[model samples]
Target: ALNKRDRIDPLEKQDSWKDFIYNPRTGEFLGRTAGSWASFSLTHPEYFLRLWVGLGLVASHCQNYNAGRTFCQSRMVSQNTGSLKRYIQASFCLSSSSGYNDSIQERNDLCMVGEYTTQDNEPIKKVCQFKRSTLRQCSGLPDPSFGFKEGKPCIIIKLNRVIGLKPEGDPYINCTAKRATSLQMQYFPSEGRLDKMFFPYYGKKSHPDYVQPLVAVKLLFTKEDYNIEQTVECKVEGSNLRNDDERDKFLGRVTFRVKVSE
Candidate 1:
């Protein structure tokens, strides 16, 4: 009779199986076997610890997917959160139509239609109006520097478009410092609330002119807070949102570091 060592899993010889567990280019296994794990931990425990920590970081930062469909309807996922900069400015290439500039949120039953060039055969869908001017200081119109010169930096946060997802309890963004020190912030569009009208995203083929809503957070740093790098975490708060996933820190939130240098 053949020993267990001679009866290796035949599936390991398959290309798909190899691709799933090993990187051909890097010559590294995606995950280790029991024997390999034990050997690595016994020999190089620090490397093994760092490997797990690296995996945790990747899981926390990566975007979540639903079923086979992507969470974002369009290319909006790439713009989920803007880069952390000393000063951030928001720019837009919006339609000149008067309706696109409306700052008021329409009734839930109604939607303001946006203008988009579509083929005659495509079905018409209502795309809600997201006023870019609501960002005020971050709009890049009033001050191109976006408050950077004044020591108050503006950061714009926009949620990725999730199809058929409607936030409950009036979702809003709340930003706080990770450290014990206080971090003061002021929000544009009042309370950093993500308006309801911009949700329930239709696909790009249907809602071609759809624009995601934005919240501008202006950090109000005191003289003492300046020159010190502070880690800030911003979360979407609502009855339906989940922001407390220990394994995934960005479930309904984003964390970034910022420092204002005078």
Candidate 2:
């Protein structure tokens, strides 16, 4: 019964569509669709919990890492300690990897006394003599293999170089097993003693022909000594040498692992 002119047509209604399509004040269209609005309103409680746990774990890991770094920095060697720190080192004899020549005659043909012509205006430093014959069976003279083929191996120990280091008292090499076990080893040159004459090595320019002293240890391995690795620690004992410092593990000692195959 209503007149068509008086009733409002749905298509002619402007407010609903106008605000969604365009803004008069900003002169811009409202771009958010129904799907975008739903996405923004949605909430995932489980994902929020997971994210919080992950962040907490990352924070804890970073804190622990910083603490460990600080501790290690504190344990670093002090700047006052000079480079003149002396120690001992062990090496395998007559092996290709050990820098020894594969030839029998060439490697063992070294002289006891090094021959060098002193330079002019340089002080003549006394060069100590070290004969390879002193090593006896471990010298590669009697057996070129140094007893490796028969399960015995020769280990050579040498003192680290330090200028003006005159070892007071007699310095000797002593080796022992790591565990509460015994290892049969024979030292060459008698009682593993390092002669006093070998001390006080002058600089290379002053003593070009100087030869460092070496102590050879011949391992007498039994049947039980094969296949399993044996840890050995050798220390040089003297008046001034120290091998028991917790701060410096290898102050005057050396450690090595050896194994012989049948």
Candidate 3:
């Protein structure tokens, strides 16, 4: 009876702790506990030690264990690093506006264009419409047509390269302008306007119809004095952004100094 019990105990332990075998729903605990192993080891130290060493050898032979661990670690690192790099690449640039040297010093120029009459002799105020040709034409020449003067001063903020964004659905970006009490910033598109359907750029070589998007911001000076110089900060917000820190990290920001003259 004792010999029979001994054979049964070994079989029980083997069935309980089979490596790599587990129930997905309930989870696997191997069949027995450490206490049971301890009790059996006391009676059969040689057998228990042999089983323990053999299990270790088996585990070491399994390459999937080490590979899985390494894969998980690599994935975590890539995610963190990729997020930071994408945030850095996203940026904003002033594409077209009024005042200063349209070609050389446009970015630093404080002069803004005011309201003026067009070829049709119609009154045009508070609107600065910029197109692709406008940017190309104004690129290095001091063109007053691109300047933003007093009553008609409007600045166009172009959304530069945004990385890690996929172009599938309609994803848009929201922008807010921070400035002094007398200045007002208005964004075009009425709502968040980056339109993900056009983004996640597939490179010019791949997609021929892809056109870079732009954001229009009209700068309004409400003070009595028309001639004033002040700095305005524009922040671009996205749906994926979570907190203030992420905004500062991932989103793009642009600062413009405006001086509207009479």
Best by TM-score: 1
* CA displacement after TM-score superposition, residue 5 of candidate 2 (Å): 71
Ranking by TM-score: 1, 2, 3
- The per-model lDDT (C-alpha) reads 0.55, 0.53, 0.34
Candidate 3 residue-wise lDDT at 208: 31
lDDT (Cα, 0-100) at 43 in candidate 2: 36
Count backbone overlaps in model 2.
Answer: 0
For lDDT, candidate 1 versus 3, the one ahead is 1
Q: Over 4 Å off in model 3, which ranges? A: 1-147, 167-182, 223-225, 242-251
How far residue 168's Cα lies from its native spot in candidate 2, in Å, is: 1.3
Pick by lDDT: which candidate is best? 1
lDDT (tens digit, per residue) of candidate 3 on 60-121? 11222221112123211001111111111011123222221233333221212231212133
Q: Mind sharing the TM-score for model 3?
A: 0.38
Q: Where does model 1 exceed 4 Å of error?
A: 1-122
In the range 13-76, model 1's lDDT, one tens digit per residue, is 6765776588576555756555776676456322211100000001111223221212123211
Per-residue C-alpha lDDT of model 2 across residues 105-212, encoded as one tens digit per residue:
233323332232233454876555466666787666676545554666666667655545555577778888776678989998788887776656566777665656
Residue 158 error for model 3, in Å? 2.1
TM-score winner between candidates 1 and 2:
1
TM-score, every prediction: 0.58, 0.55, 0.38
